[model samples]
Target: MSKKSTIQVEKVNAHIVNWLKTYAENAKVNGFVVGISGGVDSAVTSTLCAQTGLPTLCVEMPIHQAPSQVNRGREHIEQLMTRFSNVTTIEADLTAVFENFKSIVPTVPDLDKVNLSLANTRARLRMTTLYYFAGIHGLLVAGTGNKVEDFGVGFYTKYGDGGVDLSPIADLMKSDVYALGEYLQIPASILQASPTDGLFGDDRTDEDQLGASYDELEWAMLEEEQGKSADDFAGREKIVFEIYKKLNASNQHKMREIPVCFVSNDIK
Candidate 1:
């Protein structure tokens, strides 16, 4: 399985915890705040932040979220608080807030566009909520994105889940994050659950949306990094490689820094 880590799990855990602690200390922030999505990434990120021995706030901002997601998030937060004194939690139910926003916005003819916009809206709402807590509590917002989502596929929402003060696991792949989750003793309910953003208020999973499994995407990412292309593969491998390339190219805007319109002094 690609889940196996190339490095020592114990040392990686210690290194991340130390890195988080030093970053918080240097920034003069109290600790870290993470948006708990009932997924392995958030569960692992929160656990790592708790290990920093500084304040770790897990905020649940649900907008018509699934009960399973909610339950898993609560379970992880409860376990975290029990295991670490610095860990804390808050539930900011955003169902009503989301409904209000939808009602106020102008309706459009394109249902597909509206649905996609609202799904992203759900993520942005959660992002706003996390920053709110971070602002009032003097904490840094720790991101839960892994390498596959953050860079390989650009699966995250722009300025939404992607808008974070720091990313503890952005360098780790999806499989690597699961490996750390195992080391961190993350709750089995979360560790075993299918990965989802839960933004659509339904049971659809990340794979259903992405059209390929994380393992396949990981293989494609590595292959592309090693200078392979879709033309080199056949059958399912070709399909998955094409999917990865399409998403990687389309979502480059999300993965890269915002483009600035530069004007020379002469032009100005």
Candidate 2:
């Protein structure tokens, strides 16, 4: 795919439709699975899959998403229920899984380290659930991540959210995600909702973790990639630079799969 795609929202939609059709036919996939977090990224991805005329199973794995956030996710799924009659919503509540394991270690690590661990745990649980559905019904997991979230910094949990077989929006930026949601006619309420990880209370958000808002982070990342001074973003340049730097610094390992050496010189 092109780094700069000329594909408009409508064109993206057509591509999604054809891709779904071809992949399903080739793999003989019976259904689709999507992890909907009641956030914009997830809602948009799930809606795209559902609209593609498959039995897209939208799963809301609310480990710690607030009641309001849970409601938002439910509402998104409900909205899809009307359009995709084959869509089935599942509540993959992960509270028990985390609870059973959180105290197993007894001593808590540092805040940053613990938070990173928790984030990875949530993502792994989500992947497990997606595969659970896929294994039972021969479905494909429709991962909900955009370029800004997954590739720019590799800011996802490898063997977790990063373990998906296919991603529908892997090439879109944060801004483009909103535009696609609008193009897909997702509820305006969700369109306006902030990008979040739903990993904590209502106060927790992805921007908080990255230390930069959508606009600032995107601009800085783009400038950095172009070999330009990311600090040219005016008074807030420092923050933006920090955001890109932090994500890149923290998620370095998420980008690569396990590497191998020519121990036996075997192609196997």
Candidate 3:
């Protein structure tokens, strides 16, 4: 969790941009489409796509999103458009769609379950919107997930934010993503903003839900990779290690390939 040495931002940026371009060309897609949530991950992702010199469409699908989040997203899109001619922005406000769906769905007695389900519904709605744009434009849906969120903790909603055509920054750690964001000159508001999924429509951060900060989670991930267990640590470290392990175990279904039932020849 200690401040690590700086990464080779220039080289990393160029590598990802070139990789994106090559992938798009090989896939026969026109370009990339990304959902901008006014967060650092999305901002960095859209910028990387724009750098590919291909048509990068940044879509803002706000479902009861906070005003600050919407403002920051618009700011980043404006900046991106000014910098790259290939970039375009669109706003698909799905507030009414979400409300209508809520009204039609059967009401549950458990408010907690309903809230969680609705939060995930928000993410899935945005995912569907992104794919809609990608479908019409012949573009790939670029994911905005980072290492700690996507693999370490599985913080994203399955078939929601996790659903994507390609992940440009999945391998990079949260710190590494911020480094790239700095090098890419992402807007200061986004860079300084606390990392949130923006699904709950409130100010609760990822740490609030995960029970640990990204730095702590990153440390635990490294420790696990080095063959260390929760027993090795005490106090806060142990707490975080357990939290990381619990999430990793519970969310393994998200990280691995879907299970399938096969039929043997004898059965036939």
**Highest lDDT model number:** 3
Off by over 4 Å in 2: 1-7, 109-111, 230-234, 264-268
Tens-digit lDDT string for candidate 3 (101-216): 99999978999999999999999998999999999999999999999889999999999999999999998989899999999999999999998888888899989999998889
Q: Which prediction has more favorable TM-score, 1 or 2?
A: 1
User: Please, what is the TM-score per model?
Assistant: 0.98, 0.89, 0.98
| Native RMSD of candidate 1 (Å) | 1.1
User: Model 2: which residue pairs collide?
Assistant: none
Tell me the lDDT of model 1 at 230: 88
lDDT string for model 1 (1-268, tens) is 1435575789999999999999999999999999998999999999999999999999988888889999999999999999999998888999999999999999799998999999999999889999999999999999999999999999999989999999999999888988889988999999899999898888999999999999889889999999999899999999999999999999999987889999999978
lDDT of each: 0.92, 0.78, 0.94
Collision pairs in model 1: none
Q: Give stretches of model 1 more than 4 Å off.
A: 1-3
Question: What tens digits encode model 2's per-residue C-alpha lDDT throughout 39-97?
Answer: 88888888877776778888888887777778888888888998789889888788888
